[model samples]
Target: MSMFIRVKRKKTTYFLHCDPSETVLEIKQKLQALSENHVDDQRLILIANKLVLEDHKTLADQKVENDAIVAMTLKIRETGDWEEVVIDKPGEHPKPDTDAS
Candidate 1:
């Protein structure tokens, strides 16, 4: 069966259509296509358990299900480190005051 995952990074979210048997590395390759980031430079973390997805494991092996939310972190070329997760939500902004002075 086919499923989809919501891969989020900063303010962007990529809805990737995939299957349970697909390995995490495969997912990274697909993300690379859209993100232009190499598979080695990408890291995926399952939001539900905060578990880092393994490259050699299948999605089902990691218990990743349909419509799951995964955070994407990119490697910093300067420091050779993975950046922190930061998913911006649209509802996070404060609303303007409705009362007119």
Candidate 2:
């Protein structure tokens, strides 16, 4: 079955459609096409468990499921260090009333 993941970086969220058999490297390549960041300079972390994803491992192997939230970090050119994950969540919306009195 096809699934999608929410790749969040800063305030931007990328919805990528993928299959469970797809490797992490493939996901990086897809992100590279969209974000223009080299695959080598990209790192993905599963936010739910703070697990760093391996490039050679398939999504199923890593237990990344449908609608999973992955944080993308880029390597700094000068420092050669990966940037900290920063996902800017949007402001919460007020809940609708449910009372029927």
Candidate 3:
């Protein structure tokens, strides 16, 4: 029997089947296929417990169950420059800088 898990990325959520024996990397590949982002550029975090899933570990090893939600974030590697993923929520905007004369 296959288990289904929920994965959230920014404002989108995806439900995918979980293979108990598959490594985290394998799962990440499946996630990448479903997402526009690349597997190498993602950092998957379990939303329920805030655990970072390691590539070498299996889902069974991590004790992840059906309907688990994992949050996907862009993984930025150190390249001597800073790269950030900005999350823009609805109805929230950055305040403008106003200088009083």
Could you tally the backbone clashes for each prediction? 0, 0, 0
Question: Against the unseen true structure, what C-alpha lDDT does each candidate score?
Answer: 0.98, 0.96, 0.77
Candidate 2 residue-wise lDDT at 25:
100
- In candidate 1, what are the lDDT values of residues 1-101, reduced to their tens digit? 99999999999999999999999999999999999999999999999999999999999999999999999999999999999999999989789989898
* Highest TM-score model number: 1
Off by over 4 Å in 3: 77-101
TM-score of 2: 0.88
Candidate 1: C-alpha RMSD to true structure equals: 2.4
lDDT by residue (10-101, candidate 3, tens digit) is 56777888787888898889888888677778777787787889999998899888888877777556663323423345657667779777
lDDT of 3: 0.77
> Candidate 2 lDDT, tens digit per residue, 1-101?
99999999998899999999999999999999999999999999999999999999999999999999999999999999999999887764556889999
Error of 2 at 64 (Å): 0.1
TM-score of each: 0.90, 0.88, 0.72
TM-score for model 1?
Answer: 0.90
